[model samples]
Target chain A: SQQGEEDPQALSIQEGENATMNCSYKTSINNLQWYRQNSGRGLVHLILIRSNEREKHSGRLRVTLDTSKKSSSLLITASRAADTASYFCATRGIKAAGNKLTFGGGTRVLVKP
Target chain B: TAGITQAPTSQILAAGRSMTLRCTQDMRHNAMYWYRQDLGLGLRLIHYSNTAGTTGKGEVPDGYSVSRANTDDFPLTLASAVPSQTSVYFCASSDEAGGNYGYTFGSGTRLTVV
Candidate 1:
């Protein structure tokens, strides 16, 4: 089942701009993860933030998780054409739950060069 | 190591034909999973295995079957292909069951049933 739901199904941004997307989940989680998928390709892990943490960063990507709200957001700074792809948010449930990762619909970002 | 490899990158099959999508992970990860991606449905889990010789059903396991005979392989089979099953399938693996680590995904298999 889909544990998370991403808002703004699609977004358009120009090169050197920033793109941000939000994801909200319905249940308690162990962590939240972000993935990127190019057209016709598999998803690649971008970042992961544990439930106890509020924010983390990797290169140009920043992820913030709010356990209280069961929501998370991914921000890409100074985006480029190469960043044009579908970004997905996934949640890993508590240990008692299966090790499965539930994914959201994903936000398709178009970076115009 | 090849994190994960899915066979028949893409396929077109008849509605009643049976097909098996293969997945192999050379990373020797202890956890593996299968997911299907539709246009707007995102990715739905079909099956998962925490370790060799153990398997579990995921959200959309109705017409799908999975087997993890060893640490490196997990295959998904469709008893009878249907138009509704026409979607891109992805195989992923993580270091452990709790998913404290990030997952590595295979390129994916695009299956089309008519």
Candidate 2:
């Protein structure tokens, strides 16, 4: 089951630009996580924000979670070609244990040189 | 460090046949999961285990079963394959249940059922 939905199914940006993606979920969650995947590759964990955390940062990435709104956003600063990949949002529910996450369709981002 | 490994990077199976996809995690994580990825549909969970010797169904559990005999191994089985089951399968693991911690995923197995 898909618990989250991401907007801007696809995105194209030039190098040095910032990229932002938004995700909305249907249920109350324990936490929300972001992942990146290159073509034909496994997903790499990017960052996570607990329900109690309104904002968090890792390197050039920033994540904001709004439990009241059941939404989250990921921001990438100074995006480069290396940042070109599909970004996914996953939600872990309150009742679910062991990281049984429900993933969104993902946003495809292409950074042009 | 071989965080996670999946066997048979890809496979071709016939309808009504049976096959099992193997997964192993060296991280000694207590939780393991199986998910199928399809174009435009994203990744859907099929089964998961909170610890060794336990297993539970996920969203798309039909036509799939799983076993977790130890912390290092989790395998997904298809009793009877079907065309609709063709997709890229991923195996993931986390340090604990309730998944506040992020997961580490395998490269995935590309399965084709005809």
Candidate 3:
């Protein structure tokens, strides 16, 4: 089984509407990172939130993490057509010797323009 | 561009032939990693090198092998290609071991074995 799993496997929303996706992990982590993959392109780094941090924002992307719940959420405000991509959450284990990351199945999001 | 170049954007190989996917990054990063992306399985780590001259096995390292001889290049080789090895391969690198900053990924190579 994967260490991290995402909810709402797929999402579809209007261009101006907000889009939100959740990720849950099963173990302790040092940090959590979110990535976006546009169709055939490689995964692009979005945001990284440390275990001690609660929330962080970049441009229109907002990310929140809850250590107690072992989960995280990514929210895009006023989404645009370019936001149509698959979102994946990766976790860096706290006890891992190296900086290896465990990735989730990902959430496929589609923005209707 | 973050200075990562992946050669042979796509390739088709015979089942028993051997092939090597080339990956080069100009970021001078110490940690490099290889991962395979599938339909529903997301991405699985194949192999990683924390620094030049050292390599380690990842979550899925059975059929794939990788080597980081220097800081600039890391290549993944398939000893005996098989149909099951077909997948989109990605090469990623981080400034630090944990990507405290972020991970830079290549455009990716689409591989098919038949």
Candidate 4:
């Protein structure tokens, strides 16, 4: 089983609505990162929240990490149709190096324009 | 700049045949990885190399072999391809270890096996 598991395997919302996705992991991790993938391309890194950081924001994306609960949330405000993509949460084990990442099942988001 | 280039954007291979997926990066990264993506499974690492001349198995390494003879290239080979091996393959590279510095992924190679 993968270390990270994302909830709400699929989500549908309006273009202007906010979309929130959650990710939970089983082991201690050095950091958690989120990536986005289109229909037929490679994943693009979205955000990275370190274990020591509680919250971070970039552009319209806000990410929060709670080490105590081994969970994290990504919030996309004012979502757009272009944001329609699969979101995956990946974790780097506390003891692991070499840029290795373990990915979750992913959350597929559909934004109706 | 071509951060990473993957050959043969797509290919069809018959079962019991051989195939090799090529991955090259221009970033001079110390780490490279190969992952397979399937529906509902996200992406699973097949193999990885920390540096030249080293390789390690990942989550689903079965039926897949990889070699990192140099820093610029990492090739994944299937001795005898199987139907289950059909998936979108992605190659990624990073300057250091762990997720502190995220990875830059290639466009991906879609392979099908009959």
CAPRI-style docking class of model 2 based on DockQ = high
Question: CA lDDT of each candidate?
Answer: 0.93, 0.94, 0.92, 0.92
Over A3-111, each residue of candidate 2 has an lDDT whose tens digit, in order, gives 9999889999999999999999999999999999999999999999999999999999999999999999999999999999999999998877667899999999999
TM-score of chain A of each: 0.96, 0.97, 0.98, 0.98
What's the C-alpha lDDT at position A7 in model 4?
A: 90
Pairs of colliding residues, candidate 2: A97-B98, A98-B97, A98-B98
- How far residue A18's Cα lies from its native spot in candidate 2, in Å, is 0.3
Residue B39 local lDDT, model 1: 88
| Model 2 whole-model lDDT (C-alpha atoms) | 0.94
lDDT of 1 by residue, A1-113 (tens): 68999988999999999999999999999889999999999999999999999999999999999999899999999999999999999998885355678899999999999
Compose the digit string of candidate 1's lDDT tens values, residues B1-93.
Answer: 667999989999999999999999999899999999998899999899998999998889999999999999999999999899999999999
Candidate 3, residue A84: the lDDT equals 96
- How far out, in Å, is residue A47 in model 2? 0.4
Task: Please give the DockQ score of every candidate, comma-separated.
Answer: 0.76, 0.80, 0.68, 0.73
Interface RMSD score of each model:
1.3, 1.3, 1.6, 1.6
Compute each candidate's TM-score over C-alphas: 0.97, 0.98, 0.98, 0.97
Instruction: Give me the candidate number with maximum lDDT.
Output: 2
RMSD of 4: 1.1
Superior candidate under lDDT, 3 versus 4: 4
**Residue B53 lDDT, candidate 1, scale 0-100:** 94
Enumerate residue pairs that collide in model 4: A98-B97, A99-B97, A99-B98
In Å, residue B109's CA in model 4 sits off its true spot by: 0.9
Per residue, candidate 4 scores C-alpha lDDT tens digits across A15-100 of: 99999999999999999999999989889999999999999999999999999999999999999999999999999988775779
